[model samples]
Target: MTPPAITGQVALVEDDYTLVINRGTEAGVVAGMVFAVSSGTGQVITDPESGRELGRLSREKLRVRVFDVQPLFARAHTFAETDSFYGLLRIPFVATDDVVTIDVGDPVEAIAIEGMGYRKEANGY
Candidate 1:
């Protein structure tokens, strides 16, 4: 099945562990969506006259999924420290040459999800 497209800011990042995003269902987030983690590095896309390149936010494209979601109050303590949701994702695939890295307060984008064999549109969920 095609994955849904969602956008949110990165809340936290820890290699081989977990990556979290701020916006969730309250922000119209859903499960089974794929997210790409990026770093704040690269040519800045800006207007020549202004000489501003946005927020100079670079990121790494790390594919992740929305495994859990909780209300803001339910996650007040955690969200207070960081204004984002707790996203749990497992890294099952990685490139040998690609270095995996992420930082707190980055940006996340829900790309696409790979369809499962047992699930289909008509009779599957």
Candidate 2:
């Protein structure tokens, strides 16, 4: 029930469908923890005329369950799967689905943890 903290970034994704995150036991990451993975650099909104920065938009890419923990990293399984004929096609050679949403370098934060809000608005947190 510790306050939701910035855990880490997704460093890599194994071919076996495991996500390798930078946070680990030392950062309070533990088995059974769920992380809210971000889509990407996110969309940057700005003023059309002044070009002033308006805001950034981010979306929930996927949810992952941490099942293995190390001192420097953790391995997780995404809740969604890409396996249908369409899913399979996307997984192997496309960028039009949830599987494409998760990429290395995406932000990953523990969710459903104490202090972690269950729902997020369009604003990037």
Best by TM-score: 2
Quote the positional error of residue 57 for candidate 2 in Å.
0.7
lDDT of each: 0.50, 0.70
Off by over 4 Å in 1: 1-5, 45-60, 72-91, 113-125
Q: Which parts of model 2 have CA positions greater than 4 angstroms off?
A: 47-50, 80-101, 113-125
Instruction: Give the number of colliding residue pairs in candidate 1.
Output: 14
Clashing residue pairs in all predictions, respectively, total: 14, 0
lDDT of 2 at 85: 62
> Considering summed lDDT, which 10 consecutive residues are worst modelled in model 2?
90-99
- Give per-residue CA lDDT, model 2, range 1-125, as digits (tens): 54556458899998545789999888888786778788767689999999999888877777677879899899987543345564444332233543454678998878743234443422444
**Best lDDT goes to which candidate?**
2
My TM-score estimates for the predictions, one after another, are 0.54, 0.67
- 113 in model 1: Cα distance from truth in Å? 4.9
